[model samples]
Target: MNRRAFALTFGLGLAALASPQAAWAEDHLAEAVRHTKAAVDHGKQGQAEVLVTHAESALTHAEAAQKGVYNIHVEQGVSHLKAAIAEGKKSNAQGATEHAAEALTHLEAAKKK
Candidate 1:
């Protein structure tokens, strides 16, 4: 095999390996967005308990998405998720809803990035 061919093959292999990690991060980010939206919806319905559950899930996924990527939007979304969870635990539906809405916005931005 020629040097050029070998280099091309190696580059393609490396690219293939890197793509999976990118896809994994994207998948987790998408999941975080979905969960955050669910939390917002539940909070709107005054279901603090359910909102907390979804927010927790969103936080988990958001943290996972941050494993290999540093995104300010994801970080902000995580913060809002924490606040939402805390407010939900306190049965403050309004506060939780507001936080969840903020989280949704940040997560959506992160997705675009």
Candidate 2:
């Protein structure tokens, strides 16, 4: 093939490969959102156990994606929130408040980025 044809073919092939990855990321993001919601529900109900579990799951999903390209702060924030919930459940009110503050910080950072 000519140089131009080769370049064009390669570019198209690369885009084709990228499209699926993008799709997968979208799916992961959706799952992360669901997990976050679950965490929130757990928190509201004072079900710290479930909140921590959901937050961890959300964080895990976030970590699986490309860090620089993805908004991982949301997951980080939720994870912290979950940590706080767990702490509260354990009767460590001060520790829970501290973690909640940290979670807010991460969430704010994520928004800035």
Candidate 3:
């Protein structure tokens, strides 16, 4: 009975992994959006350090999304995200905010496709 149960569990896990059920591109895009929102909020409060953290996360997710399905908008978003990070690290809140917003716009457009 234990052996049977183990086999069943293993088989189910393999099947679940093989299934093309999840939308990976969408998931990555969603993560990017969430982090971008947080970054925007932090930027508004002039928290450049915190904003940079979220912007980095957003950039990671954006790059993941770009990998799943190549899109020009996603590529542009990655570029903007990089700029946001650079500006944030330099303690330039205004520049970071602008770049982060640009990244979001590109990400949103990519999400639609």
* Best lDDT among the predictions, by candidate number: 1
On TM-score, the stronger of 2 and 3 is 3
TM-score of 1: 0.88
Candidate 3 Cα RMSD (Å): 5.9
Q: Candidate 3, overall lDDT?
A: 0.89
The digit string of per-residue lDDT tens for model 3 on 57-94 reads: 99999888877778899899899999999999999988
Per-model TM-score versus the true fold: 0.88, 0.63, 0.80
Clashing pairs in 1: none
Clashes of 1: 0
In model 3, what is the error at residue 103, expressed in angstroms? 0.4
Order of the predicted models by TM-score, top scorer first: 1, 3, 2
Per-residue CA lDDT of candidate 1, range 13-44, in tens?
Answer: 99998889888989999999999999999999
Candidate 3, run of 10 with poorest lDDT: 17-26
Q: Per-residue alpha-carbon lDDT of model 2 for 25-83, expressed as tens digits?
A: 55655565566566666666666666667666765654554342466676666577667
* Whole-model Cα lDDT of every candidate shown, in order: 0.94, 0.63, 0.89
Name the lDDT value of residue 6 in candidate 3.
Answer: 100
